[model samples]
Target chain A: MSTKSTQIRLAARPVGEPQDSDFEFVTTELPALGDGQVLLRTVYLSLDPYMRGRMSAAKSYAKPVEVGDVMVGATVCEVVESRSPKRGVGDLVLAYTGWQTYAVAEAHHTRRLDPGAAPISTALGVLGMPGFTAYAGLLEIGRPQPGETVVVAAASGPVGSAVGQIAKVKGARAVGIAGGAEKCRALLEEFGFDAAVDHRSATFRDDLEAATPDGVDVYFENVGGPVSAAVVRRLNKFARVPVCGLVANYNATEAPPGPDRLPGFLGAILTLSLTVRGFIQDEFVPTRHDDFLREMAGWLRDGSVRYREDIVEGLEQTPDAFRGLLVGRNFGKLLVRVGEDLTRE
Target chain B: MSTKSTQIRLAARPVGEPQDSDFEFVTTELPALGDGQVLLRTVYLSLDPYMRGRMSAAKSYAKPVEVGDVMVGATVCEVVESRSPKRGVGDLVLAYTGWQTYAVAEAHHTRRLDPGAAPISTALGVLGMPGFTAYAGLLEIGRPQPGETVVVAAASGPVGSAVGQIAKVKGARAVGIAGGAEKCRALLEEFGFDAAVDHRSATFRDDLEAATPDGVDVYFENVGGPVSAAVVRRLNKFARVPVCGLVANYNATEAPPGPDRLPGFLGAILTLSLTVRGFIQDEFVPTRHDDFLREMAGWLRDGSVRYREDIVEGLEQTPDAFRGLLVGRNFGKLLVRVGEDLTRE
Candidate 1:
């Protein structure tokens, strides 16, 4: 049988901040599932800062979604019809179903998710890509040692919160920087971050300095802008910076006027003996993904780690929710609940 | 017996380009050598760009030259008198004696150099700190894979020359960047670099692009101004930037006018997944120095690596020779002939 899938397709390439004009809602008919294919209904659609990159034509680690294409994202879906033995109907699965409510994916392409183990939605957040990004980037690149200080921005979000928590797990002090007192409080109170500094505070620089007495040894870079610049200035000698995302500048139209400080930036890198490495999450999958799964799941189970899901009601809320993500409006792991999960409800 | 030692002391810290008035020359009396102590006559005094850092009071890996302190440097000296079993009268040695005609040091503090094995001046150039800077930083941090492209600036100088030649030894394509046609010629003819781009040339950017068609895999960053800016722009994904020095900005009094490109720089580090590491060569001593000595000696013997020296006639000419090094005036490894080597003649 077939199903109707409602998707948010790329309407136009964004100039700066993505607008309603940049996306178009479309309902398409899915053809009958072929052999070795599974018809899936997306229970939870992931909304991440990385989605902004897919919206633009800019060159990045991954290819941008072309105009007239479905906006891509990780989805926690329910298998509705299976044409292969690899998956069964009513089984929860993880799939790349983009911004759609339903998809026809090959059986091998979808991983079966056990509903008994935590929640299926986590495959898009803490137990999945975002968590793995924090894990692999922080440990492999940052390599924060005992008694060292790790600083991460966007601290209330999945990646930054995970980075802070992981640094603490490694015996390093975690300093979290967020946009407001509310988020900063959540960083320390909810995520158990060692310290939280409000990036929007009038005395943000002073607060950052006060938060990290020993200086930042590892800076898990998620938000890149003035916040990153201030943090980088306070980096200790031999500091490690793992550049995971630049959500701050995702909407920038052009480079700001400059005396061009790339030289001074390089000068600081030289004098301080800094290690600045940029990476995406997938690079460490072969070796680190399993460890991330086992560890993060344990941390969640034992109450050592906590997660918050900010779920918008429907597929239509995806764009606005994503726009909120770039501006630090989302409080935690942002997700769009496109349809009811039959496994739970 | 007592002897008179002529030394150059820092009269004051430099503001930008070091002035003659910033230095004071003095002839002081030295007492008779004690047990295990040696009185040495300076042979070759190494003049390097890192000295610019020492002339400033800024924080660095090593301490700065204090006002009224003898200007610190690496020196090749002849032992005029020794009161130890480790060395006898007339033995050549390497010592941190600074810019001076003579010094009194403990015999164990100096490493005796065999004049019969190689020219004693080599201990200050290709076989010393600069060469080791190239060796350790390039191998340990840069780690250029075979068939990859390795680019280094200051092409004819000790560090950059060794970096290019060693890159060739490791089966990578070595591209050299220098200031003038003469240095550019030496990069190809003397150092056997695959391509040489003159930084002073108007077509430098285009030339660099042509030279590095596969994109820069490793950039041995020594100079950090426009040359570095151009090189960094062409770096491939996962490029290794072992930032050994920033000779171009060593004398800058303030941050240049900015569109403040640090954010964009961080963005590139994120998008390209570049590995930018800064280091001082001394950190790798215990782990890699022995390997450097053995391997570099073999390469020099087989002519797989070649070196050149620009020797100034007298100690009084040291200041001019040093000033020349910062502006790419000297053709090769710069040295000052502080006192004649009787063994060589």
Candidate 2:
């Protein structure tokens, strides 16, 4: 077993966009596993937009990962050794091992990955938490009927991509909004979205207006900024807004300047009888997890749902890769290849 | 039969708080009534906060009352004479008669009011649409569970008072927020609220915090301003907000200055899994109106629910009375006694 492990610890609570100095990489010795524990080496670390929330001490659905803690994350790992009766050495498993090369955890804390079904790395991306979030939030809350328009921003990310495709499967018109034309084009060509609007265009508002002529019925809101503002304008009566994440304003240092528009927004809510609900996907897990696994596994098997991953090399590159996530730099599900995958079939 | 009748017509759209010049009160000769039409005399006119929405040309759930037209309103009137066999002379009925002393309406357009069941004027207050608004919005959307704390503002008014009491009937703790000590006292002593907080007091924020220690499960939102800001801070996870009106901002000529807090508000919505829905009572009328009528009528008969009315004398005082309603001057459901109720049994 490897004695030394490389880990990234949070140095400070970021005020807005996180900086490199906010993290400290350290080499630490891994302690021996207990009777029920296993030694695991991380092969892939998932960098998600939600990590931005955990970096800040702001009130949220989950507690912010404390400063100086190995920045918390999900990882796909190869089990090095096991003391538990349930596990064996060389097993590939999924774990919440944070930004680290290796760690020791209880055997029950990790789920063994079946590489025959798909690539082991997929346990950290497309068939993982982000994908599940989109599926549950859209189906349970958005509840788009056939022929209704489903609008989603951050369209190229794991969650948004899954949301758009799921809406299509439900027979709803999927409208994807992304930062540039490339991602927008990918939304239509790769993800099978009915319409894709480039939010970076100077005429983005007009483009959105032209694209969704029937108005938005279910807005799977992940990016809340100018894109959300434009979407709000196009919302039809009785529109449903599932507030999953607000990546656009996650780095905000202070409240934006205003002739406060909340009253106007509330006026729209009243006049249109709109339903604006905010949710974290974990709330729906207990009720819908089984249904999700069965349906998503079926969808994947049939090629009804497709996904992409943007993999970065090495644990040392995670900080830079994560910084790109907030500013829309990465093209797909951003993951850092922490270690070599030696168990691939 | 009298040929002359006085009518109040919308002269021009008011920019903010309505002015006397914006309403033109003119005496006009009544047109001859055709078959199936009845000549009605307005007895009690309902002056509600929603009338303000009609005065504006902005798009809303309902069409805007056009300028130069008689200002739309709900009225309890006496059928003075009838050309239709369905409505008899001297019958009391609820009609959409607008702000006029007398008007001719189709006999089928009005529902006969039973003076014996309750006072005829109660048709415009507790036994009518405003009361039903409180019932449907609270039970259907707010859905306060037993032992949960339900909070409502404008607690001295018809809608808010009913919400608080109905919440109590459902085994929830009812916290009533009113503008002054007297209204607050009425909420506790007269309406049987579990707790009453005076929003006018300098210690209102702390008082509200103390009153709702377990956090608010349902907020029956009628008056939205500082009161809403205070109540929002006390919302529990999965808190349901049934937004019925925003009386506090009704007269605002400009958006209030702010370090815009909308992002923060949306953040709270995400973190708390809050459900904020805006609805006009009429929307639910088709589905839940019968249920509301059965439940509210039973509650009133058993003394489980009570109501208050603030009656202003004569049609001439309506403009000032309405201006008062905008600023929370009237203590309860504000109504105008247009004429004597001679047909009362």
Candidate 3:
């Protein structure tokens, strides 16, 4: 096993879209594992839109990643050296080792992943934070009733796909909004969304209107921009918006210019009685984690839910892949294959 | 008794602030009372901020008052002539009589008021829609826990005052924001608010900062403008905003100028995990009305809650009184005395 670890750290905060100059690659000697700790080799590093927020000096639910600090993220890893009974060598586990090929993590901080039950990488995608965000935010805050229409953007991505499928499981009519025709097609074919609207099309507004003839009841807001503005107009009275992310605005350098729509939005809130709630998934883990693990596993087993992953080849592609994430360049749950999956070998 | 009702009708939609020309005084002859109907003499006509929305063609929770139609409003009335067994002549009751001296309404449409229990005028203010609005919106949506800080603007008005008092009743510290020093004084002294900030003062923001030592947990939003914007900045994580009104924007002719703030506000919702919920008081009538009546009656009886009123003389004064209501000229619940209260005599 290699005694040195190659890691990516934040070099400087980016102005808008993150660039290559924003990241610094470093090689460091791995410290000897302490008691109750495991030295893990990263097999997959999850790349998400929220990483964009962490890269900036912005006030968010989580603290911004400081310059020169290792970029924060969730990773699926293989424990290579174990000093605790909780984990053994060659055991695959879900860990938050960030953007590094190797990390010495406390054994209790990691959860064992059963490869036989499901693919180990599924622990970082459909069975992980993103999936739990869909489960808790939709069911707890959105509260979609039977026959109600639910609209979500970034429809081909992990959270959005899970939201649509779960909305279906709850007997709701799911409408997916994606940037391209291909993603929209996948929303209907692979994810089983009731309808899909291509937001990139010139007739997007009309398409959205036709798709949501009954009006939207639950809007699982993952991407915010003109698409969200259009969707807000189609919301029914007493509609619930569980805002989990705003990928479209994550790279914005300044506020958009125009006849300020804040007052107008507040007017709609008062007149239509809308509920707009923002949340971080961790807040729900204490209450809904067990339910999410059990129900999502059943859905995966029964084909009630399906997930797709877009895996890049190496750790060095982190910066570019993340930028692509904010712009919806890569579809599915974007991940970086930091090292070889030795278990599969 | 005169067989005519002199009313102020909507002449035309106002450009910004409502003007005298926008209202037309019309004297209409009353139709003969039919079975199950009563001739009601309007004693107190409530002039609220919502009336401004009714005068315009803007989309709102309720329909706008049509041009050439009598301006709609709630009123306390005396039954002058009855043809139904449900009500008797000289009984004090609550009715939707608009800005008129007399209205012929079905007896079943009016709720009989017991003058011995409370002042009959309160049936239109503290014990009416405004009171219920504060009750249901604050309790159901705001849900301020004990030891939390609750903030409200237009704190001298019926709804705002009731919201502050009720927050205190729930064991939360109440902070009030009002337009003038006198109103702020009333908020602290009369309404028993823990702290009061004068929005008209130059030190308004600083005062608000000092007032809410513990960040706001619940914001009962009745007035929306700079006051609300400032309060939002002071909100703690997971704060709740029960938006019941936006009186400041009711007369806005067009959307405000460049640098749209909607995105920033939504960003705040995301980062702080805030819940911004809008509601019409009537939605809670079925679920919370009985509890409100019982609790509010007890609070008033035991002096736990206190109310104030600003009564304008004559139905003809409604137009000016209503215009004043939009600008916070009236200090308390604004009402027009349309006719002499025969029961008081």
Model 1 regions more than 4 Å off: B31-35
> Which of the two, 2 or 3, has more TM-score?
3
Judging by DockQ against the true structure, name the best candidate: 3
Worst 10 residues of 3 chain A by lDDT: A336-345
Worst 10 residues of 2 chain A by lDDT: A336-345
- The TM-score values for the models, in the order shown, are 0.97, 0.98, 0.99
Best by lDDT: 3
* Per-residue lDDT value at A164 in model 1: 90
Q: Give each model's whole-structure lDDT.
A: 0.90, 0.90, 0.92
Q: Distance (Å) between predicted and true CA of B125, model 1?
A: 1.6
Model 2, residue pairs in steric clash: none
| Clash count in backbone of candidate 3 | 0
In model 3, the runs with Cα more than 4 Å from the true position are: B343-345
Query: Which residue segments of model 2 deviate by more than 4 Å?
Result: A343-345, B343-345
Clashes of each: 6, 0, 0
Write one digit per residue (lDDT tens) for candidate 1, span B1-345. Answer: 679999899999988888899989999998888999999999989999999999998888778889999999989998898899998888889999998899999999999898887788888878899889999999999998999999999988999999999999999999999988888998888889999999899999999999999999999999988898899899999999999889889889988886777777788888899999999988899999999999999999999999999999889998878888898899889989888878767
If you assessed candidate 1 against the hidden native complex, which CAPRI class would it receive?
medium
Question: What DockQ values do the models have?
Answer: 0.75, 0.82, 0.87
